[model samples]
Target: MKRTLHTVWLVARRELRTRVQTRAFVLGTLFMALLVLAFPVVTLFAGASNAPEDELSASDSTTRLGITQSANGLADPLERKAGVDRPAISVRKVADTETGKNLVREGELDGVVAGTPTAPELFVERHVFPHLERALTTITYNNQLDAEMSRSGLDPEAVRDRAGRGEVAIVSMGESQGAADGPMAGISDAEKAQRLIIAMISTFLLYMFLIMTGQMISQGVVEEKSSRVVEVLLSTIRSTELMAGKIVGIGLTGLIQFAVIGVLGFTAATATAVLTLPTFTVAGLLGWAVLWFLLGFTLYATMLAAASSLVSRQEDLQSVITPVIMLLIVPFFVGVSVLPTNPDGTTGTVLSMIPGFSPMLMPMRLALGGVPLWQGALSVVLSLVASAAVLWLGGRIYSNAVLRTGARVRLKDALRAS
Candidate 1:
């Protein structure tokens, strides 16, 4: 047993050294790290550019109006009706109707109030602002109503006071309930949005990592078999050990790249203030992502290596490994398309607990925050169980088929081989 472990370790070390020292691995890692670092910086500048425009719009919200002598009495009422919620009304007295019209046309004012308080006429350069128009209309209507009430021997001020007091009481059930104590409790809308972003990013990275590493494992196996390298290696180490060592070595390489990218992305996002999540929260998400990757890579890599061993040439490797690739692809599309809008929906919740789907879906739910502890624990357990079974079965197929060269060996023949 000790000798077997020593052989596996030696092979793992050799594979790791070969992969890490490759030009492709070094350049790919550097490029991905740079890209991750640049994302937050780009977002920060884009937001910065649009911020000034928003501030300018808010600072210049006052509506300027000109009033002629005929409508001079309406000024106080209009000011009062404008209220604090609507835009502030800036009233200027004009000499005559023509002067007010000229002021509006010259862009010096938003609108002109002429005629009389009860029969006011508004002139504007183009369209009147909605709030300003509403205020003017309300003031005119009140004046006419007040005059009618006075004619009828009713107190207009007393009537207004009673009407003002008859406001509809608003009772919001959502607000009254306060924050929920269950999953998704107490999370603000902004935080939810941030969680969704984190979920999406996690899903994408896992998908890419799985695809890249799965292919690497399959191709590496086929390359060794085709070139008779496995024959030489097998003479020294058992087939199972060779397969185990390759999976470990390639997995570690992928893990290194994955960690570098994740750390760089989080660091950049935090430094640029793009992500408002606490450091521990971000770190926890990253930790979950790493865990899922290791589990996913193990389960898929074993099957892919076993599949590739059936074929001696790289050309036929795709036919054998396409099904495993599809397994990775289906969950990726499902999670990315469904989870963003409905992270806690029944479909995601259930699928995330399944072995094949969990690695891709569970991490997304966890990153979105509010996933129950049982669900996360169950998914991990199921995946580990599935991986162990696959590893055992895949080891048999690879051991029987890897040394067989020439035309593609059927899976049944490989499994049934002595």
Candidate 2:
């Protein structure tokens, strides 16, 4: 057992050194790191660009209007009708129509009102703002109605009082009743949005890492077999040892790259203020992501290595590995498409617990927050179990078929081989 472990460790060390020294690995790592760093900087700039406009809008909350003498009575009614929800209205008397138009054009006032209180002409730089327009329309209509009621010998004050009291009491049912104490409890809308972004980004990175590492393992296996490198290595080390070493080494390499990227992303996002989640929360998400990557890489790498052993050449590698690729792809698309809008939906919740799907889906749900502890625990347990089984079966197939060469070995023949 000691000798076997020593051999595996030697082979693993060799594989890791070879992979890390490659130009592709170095360049790919650097490129992905740069991209991760760039995302937060870009988001920060994008938000900063619009900051002034938003601040200006918030600071200037009052709508100033110049009203002519004929419409003087509207000053009080306009302010009153503007309502508590809308911006405050500040009305000032204007000398005449030309004067009011000049003030509006000069930007000293938001708008101008002329004619009598019942029949007002509004002037502005362009179109009237919605709140001010609504207020003017309501006040003018009420004035006309009051005049009509006076003619009919009805009390306008009583009618106005009754109408004012006829407001509809709003009852919002948009939020679930138990949301305050449920999975999403204590998270604000802004935080939820940030979490969604983080989840999406995490999902994408996991998917890419899995695809890249899976291909690397399959390609490495096929390349070694095709060049008879495995044959030479088998003379010194057992086939199972060689396969285990490759998976372990390549898995470690992938993990390093994954960690580098994750740390860069977390640092950049927090430094730029793009992510406002508690430090512990973000770190926890990163920790879970790393865990899932390890489990996912192990499960997929073993199968891919086994699948690649069925073929002797790189040309045949794609056909054998395409199914595994699809496994990764389908779960990826499903997670990204379904989780963002419905993080706690039945589909995401259930799929996140499935072995093949969990590696991709579970992390996303976790990142989005509110995932149950049992669900996460179950998914990890299932993945570990599935990976062990795949390792056993895949090791058998690889050991059986990796020794054979020439035309592609059939799956049955590989499994049935002595």
Candidate 3:
């Protein structure tokens, strides 16, 4: 066991060294760093430049603060008080229906409030965004202070006092399924939002890495085969060992690249205040990323090694790899689609169970607070078993055909040799 591990490590280190030294790896990593950094900078600029105007525009600012006329006079001083220091709020006594409609269309008033002893009725043409709409609602409610008084069964002044004193306890049973004990059960809205952002980022990275790294492995193999290097290497090392070394080496290279990109991205996000330092615990993300990365590479690497054996030339590489590429690509789209609709849906559960898809699906499930301990354990076990099978079977094919040249190797020949 130790010897095998040492061999894997030696091969992995050699591969890692070769990959990092390559011009393509350096350029690709630099590009990723710039790309990730650019996003936060762009977002910060957009947010800063697009600050809400100091004054709501005349067309948009015109809002009607409604009042009810009692037999004696206007109900309360609430309308005037609510609009204090706010020039945009215009109090309008809606004595007639026609006057209200006309004012709204002319943009002379943004909305209408039918004031009663109860809470006023706000009639806006459309659902306004929350901030402005909130201001309107508060002003209207104060103008007709009847409902709050009735609900509290207290004097108007007492009702207002209690309303002011009452604290808002917003409890969100997260996962959107109303399930208790979710990861978000005790978390605040801000933390929940942060978790959501992180989950999205994690999913995107998982998908991106799988696509990019898998292709890199396939393409690297094709290049080596086309250049006739595999023929020379075959004499020194067994085909299986050669393929294993390449995959391990390439996977290590990809992991290193991924780590660099992640660190750069986190630094950029922190500097921009896009992600708070507390929100970006490296240990947590690295733990998850490393686990998923291995699972993903192990699941796909053997296929890549085997597929490369089918093609002897660069041009034929695409055709041989097309099926495996399609398989890998399909999960990304399927996982993405399933993530939103049912984060823990039947489809997600099934996908999580499949060794080939467990890497992507399990991380998503963990993020969404859907994975159970037993299920997670099962997924790991299944993935290991599948990876072992793939490595053994794929190595057989690779060993038989990697030495062949001039034409693509047939599946029958590979199987027969095996």
Better of 1 and 3 by lDDT: 1
- Which regions in candidate 1 have their CA more than 4 angstroms from the true location? 51-183
lDDT (C-alpha, whole model) for all candidates: 0.83, 0.85, 0.66
Instruction: Please give the RMSD to the true structure for each candidate, in Å.
Output: 11.1, 10.4, 9.4
Which residue segments of model 2 deviate by more than 4 Å? 51-183
> In model 3, which runs have C-alpha deviations exceeding 4 angstroms?
1-11, 47-183, 277-282
Candidate number of the best lDDT: 2
lDDT of 3 at 60: 49
lDDT of 3: 0.66
- Residue range 1-418, candidate 3, lDDT tens digits: 5665566667667778877898988998899889988977876666556643222432244445444352113324434433322334556576654566667777666666564433445555554433344554555566456656666686877666878897643322122223222244544343345455666677778778877778777777777777888777666656666677778888888788788877777778667755542432433554566688888887787887788777877788888878877777777777777865576778888897787777777776665553566777788889899999888888888887777776889877986785
Worst 10 residues of 3 by lDDT: 172-181
lDDT of 1: 0.83
Better of 1 and 3 by TM-score: 1
Residue 244 accuracy (lDDT) in model 3? 72
Q: How would you encode candidate 2's per-residue C-alpha lDDT over 1-418 as one tens digit per residue?
A: 9998998899889889999999999999999999999999898778768554223234577888999999999999887766543468888999999999998888899889999989999898866366677777878898899999999999999988988897643221112233223336546566688888988898899999999989889989999989998888988888999999899899888999999999999999987777756666777788888899999999999999999999998988889999989989999999889989988899989999888899999989888877656677888999999999999999999999998999888889888887
Backbone clashes, candidate 3: 0
Rank candidates, TM-score, best first.
Answer: 2, 1, 3
